[model samples]
Target: MVHENKHVKNARYVRTVESMFACPVCRASMKVVHYQSLICSNHHTFDFAKRGYINFMNQPVNTKYSKGLFEARRKLMTEEAFFEPLSHAIASAIHAHVAKPKKTSSILDMGCGEGTLLSTICNKVSSRGIRDVIGAGSDISKAGIAMASKNYSDKVWTVADIANPPFKESQFDVILSILSPSNYAECNRLLRTGGIVVKVVPRSGYLKEIREVLFHKATKKYSNEATLERFSKHFQVAEHFRLCYTTRLNPASMKWLVQMTPLTWSLTEEKEMSLAEEISNQITVDLDVMIGISPK
Candidate 1:
């Protein structure tokens, strides 16, 4: 049986009601009725199937991310534990940055694949009683968001394009982008004046073990200085942390392991076949986590 997040089950229905309505066409005000579709005053409407998620992509999103890919990602995350350190890093950053007491904290996780990082942070916050979280997880992949919404029923999960998210201006106090593409202009529009954006990008050495096996060469592009420089163009840099951790992946996780990565797309058929045979037993896990804050 699939394990669902119980915190989602315990949340008040009112929270779910308020969280579901975001206009798909205009990204403006919407009213959700019958737990199905959200309709805006402009007459634009979006439907949420019985599984519990709404698709808000204005134009067709052309990509390889599918239901199988997201399921593989979720399975790999749960089995290989790729996000354990990442989650702690995010929670710690939030605790360190939010100095003042807040009545509620709003977090918008863009390109949130299967809701692993966001769900982990929410569980941490609830367990510690740091603050009530209005956690919203969005992705361009409708299948991904649908899976996330079903598993994390309480979160405001939507099939939203990161380049143009469906929400009002300056709504989120914290935005997260983990190992995914980001639209800085849209992110800036969605965040409050002094909100924070925590990003996790792979360093050169990240998953060196996997790269070493999967391909002949892999780039260690997008240096920290470069990232900070790019982000500084929009928001001030608050703090930087270099996070690295090593863990071993079990044999059962190897298939999902390959499916869970960008490497899946990067590797050639011959190289992928070779990599699959090389370490069918176990493999190493490596990654980096970075955080930036909005201007005060």
Candidate 2:
């Protein structure tokens, strides 16, 4: 099978996602023009890169989530099914929240890093007979969007700030934020009336093994109580689900697990080798899934 070039591959994503985009400068409605740029009513325009993703920022912003980090995460998740359970949970929540599964729906994944979680959930939801669904993802990191656009060309991938997303108001049916920062005000504005927001945050036990390996103390306590409190200010508090699971790991998968996380990204080759046995044994994934809605 022949692989399409970036231009051809991204053309579809560009079209599917164009309607939701607004002018970053003026916040006006935008449309795809000449298949090369997105033009708004006020005349501010953003161009599509050769790879087909749009750059909506006036200037580049630096972030720690580099190409290497995203690549490592993609490899780890794809190969080991690290976040498979979370993806399934998110997809199920979306399905349940949608009043009409057969009708067209749209989802925006805020701060999507290399698009694994969002891409997986979107594909899985479609497989369940939700055929007319569109997925879009944005991140402030250019490297993150570039990696995501390359792998998942079917979804809208953009290099823009998640705090002020470059999208139209009331355009999305569901918004997903998994272990990523949230701009509650923008999320509230972007969702349609009664739209659902599914946000996953780390619990105290999350990645305890890796934390122990690095800090020698995984006993520290943490809480997301403040996050829920803040979220309630924007949307009615719905339901919160706690998912706690333990994963057994082999040497190779464990290597990716430790390396892919920022906590261990600084581990020297020698240090990693020395601590290999301890970190490679097992890990815990403890997270809280909070579902919210801006009541109509």
Candidate 3:
């Protein structure tokens, strides 16, 4: 058998994702105009890269997250089993909320840092019984999308912003925003009727150990009450699933965790350097998963 080049495999994947995408400029339906490019009626086009992802950004984004951080987070997320529980929770939520009419479901993860959560959740859901689950992830960070596409080649990955998603109307069965910001208006616009929006927010105790080590008084106490209140305004809150647990962190994992998060960025170099040794302890994973829907 002749082995297909990486670019050829990626070009084929482009066909699978065409229906979900629209021309970011004209909002027209996109087609696989070429093996390596997607084009819309208005002639707007985006090219698929050799590594199996597409860059659909209209403008450059300057974010606090860097490639190094995303790489580290991906390592902990997949190899070290950091967020397996949350992945299962997300999979279960999708299974329960997805419309019963269709056997196949399409899911999109907004602000998907390196696509770890989406990949893990979709894989789990499919493994259990739902073999027709299709998952895609998008983020403003090109570096993050690059890593995601390289590692999780099966899922469609793109570089796009949440405020203006590059997907068509009624394209997705579920939209996931895990530990990331949400644009409810855009999410509602992209979902099918009775489609689901799964938003994961951090609870008060999330990463409390790291917080305690970094700042005691000046740091704002964690809160999601305001966020939930905001979500309720845009979506009908169907369910609020909470996942709170503790996981032991070794020095290596702790180092990556600290480096991955932006919380330590504000600290002085001396404080950050001095605090590294104290992170080898149990850390809390407190999160509230909100399942919501737009007004029908």
Candidate 4:
């Protein structure tokens, strides 16, 4: 593997981060220190891991994003090849919205699971001669953020709450939220006046094979209407499209999918075992990519 000076590299990350965050407790400026935490003048401190990510959330957390869930997500994502098309869609959308003659720009991937999508976008942008773009991703799960930081040390990865991003206001050019929750007011607070928010949600028939095994009856809940309602409240549409792809999942990956995805959480032990037995090979994969622009 590769190892470099975290402190020196972190200085670059801190420079950009200070531009996207405010003190959640006091709304003052926060600074990045070698301790890997964001500290305010009032002495409210957050901890950063050896992997080079800091958790800016103030209080305790009680979400389903435990270490096990993050671990399962990593294993499945790495093995199942779920990110290729999604990354392409993200890169295409970013290219459409980004302007030229820019120095170092920033993109924050909120609820970035394992940093795959952001890393892919950065590499693609760099290939197109935009060497100064940065891909920063943050998640509530420490393990998730830790894995991302360790693997993609070249980028800025943090364990920050999007509700209160640990960076300055009006600093990011693009904010991405894929298969995660969003707070549009917070997103607007982070973006520049003309910045963009690229969000990805599941379409009507996303992950049907997994859903079939996990639930006896499945209903379409994550529709474009629900997301558009939220986005309309804060953002205007610059461009929008749907990305659809079909792929097959292996056995181990299929099992990991069952555990990692929220769809199977309600399944009983007996039902889960039966579902596992019923699966042989290949599960369907589908998702949508939505791109929106902040009102200038």
Candidate 5:
């Protein structure tokens, strides 16, 4: 048996969902041309990289996230199964809210760093018997999207700005924002009627152990009240679920956790090591999942 290259595999998958895309430059409809590039009516074409991901940005953008950070995140997510429960909850919400199981359901993961959560949730949804699911992920970080395309070939990955997503309006059945920044306006425009948005935000107790060690007393407490309020303003809140658990990680996993999160970005190498050592083993994960319906 012969194995297809990433370019061939990604092109085949993109053809199925070509109509979902809009030109990032002209906002015109786009179609896959010659199984190599996506060309719009205005002839603005975006080529797929050899590694199987399309870059939709007109100009390159710099982000703080690096290749090493995404790699660490993937290790923790896949090897440690640190986010298995949260992934399960998001998949369950999608399964419950998606109206027609027989029809092909389109899902977009915005701010999908490394694409692990998107791939995991899509797999879970498929396992629940919803086989006809189309999954796509986009992030501003080229590093993240590159890792995602290399690791998860089944889904379409793009390096795109979430604020100005390169997709047609009302194209998606479900939009997922998992512990990442969100663009509610774009989400409102991208979701089809009867579609749902799953937005996950961290609660005050989320990673409190690390916060206590790294932050001052005044800055240690975190809250999502503002985020929840903003989400409710854009869509009707349908269901809210809180997921909390404590996971004990080995020293290596703890090191990855510190490297993966932005909370440690400001810390010096010495401080990061100190914080990691102080946290020891047990860490708390507290999050709230919000299922929202776009208002008419």
Candidate 6:
């Protein structure tokens, strides 16, 4: 048997969902040409990387998230099962809300870091009987997308900006924003009329152990009131679920916990080392999973 490289496999998969994409430059429909490049109707083109992900941004945009951060995050999510309950909850929300007359669905994860949440949710949804599901993940961080493509080759991975996503309007049945920033308007444009958006936001107690070590008393407490208000402004919230749990981590997982979040970004090398050592073995995972239907 001839072996196909990652690029070949990804290009073939993109061909199946080619209509879901719009040229980032021309906003025209795109099709995979010669199993290598995605060419638009107006002749604009984007090539797939050898690692099986597409870079949709015309210019490079640097972010604070690095390869090491995403790697550490992947370890915590995959090895430590840090967000297992949250992933299952999101899958349940999708199964409950999304219509299944055709028995098929398309899901897009905006600001998907390392693609673990999206990939896990996809599997859970499929296990729930939605076998014909298409999963796509996008993040501004090229490093995150690269890691995602390498690990989850079955799904489409793209380095894209959430604020201005490069996709056709009303092409997705569900849009997910997991502990990441969201652009409600872009989500509205991306979802079908009756489609849903599942957004996960951190509550006050989320990562409280780490927060206590990294911040002053005033800055340690976190709130999602403003975020909920903004989400409600754009969509009619169908369901609101709060998930809270505690999980114990080993020393290596604790190290990953410190590196996986932006909360520790402000700490110096010495302070970071001290803070990592200070964090306890138990960590809290408190979150709000909101399912909203676009008013459009």
lDDT tens per residue, model 3, 116-215? 8888888877876775888889999988888888888888888888887888888888899988888888999988889889999888778878888777
Which stretches of model 6 miss by more than 4 angstroms? Answer: 216-222
Clashes of each: 0, 0, 0, 5, 0, 0
Highest-scoring model, TM-score: 6
By lDDT, the better pick of 1 and 3 is: 3
lDDT of 2 by residue, 30-129 (tens): 8887677788999888887877788898998877676777887898789889888888888888777766735678889998888888889888888878
- With a 3 Å backbone cut-off (N, CA, C), the pairs that clash in candidate 5 are none
True-vs-predicted CA distance for residue 158, candidate 6, Å: 0.9
lDDT of 6 by residue, 1-296 (tens): 99999899989998999999998887899999999988999999889999989898879998989898999999998899999999889889888888776478899999998988899899999889986889999999999999999999989999988876879999999999988888999999999988999999888898888877666453346678888898999999999888999999988898888888898887776876678788889999999989999787
In model 5, which range of ten residues has the least summed lDDT?
214-223
TM-scores for candidates 1 onward, in order? 0.85, 0.93, 0.93, 0.85, 0.94, 0.96
lDDT, each prediction: 0.71, 0.82, 0.82, 0.73, 0.89, 0.89
Looking at candidate 1, the ten consecutive residues that score lowest on lDDT are 5-14
Q: Could you list the CA RMSD of all candidates, in the order they appear?
A: 4.1, 2.1, 2.0, 3.2, 1.7, 1.5
User: Residue 174, candidate 4: how far off, in angstroms?
Assistant: 0.8
Cα lDDT, model 4, residue 289: 68
Please report how far candidate 5 places residue 213 from its true position, in Å. 1.7
- Model 4 lowest lDDT segment of ten: 212-221
State the lDDT of candidate 1 residue by residue for 142-202, as single tens digits: 7787788778876787777787677887778889988888888877877877788887777
Which pairs of residues clash in candidate 1, taking residues 3 or more apart in a chain or in different chains?
none
lDDT at 148, model 2 = 82
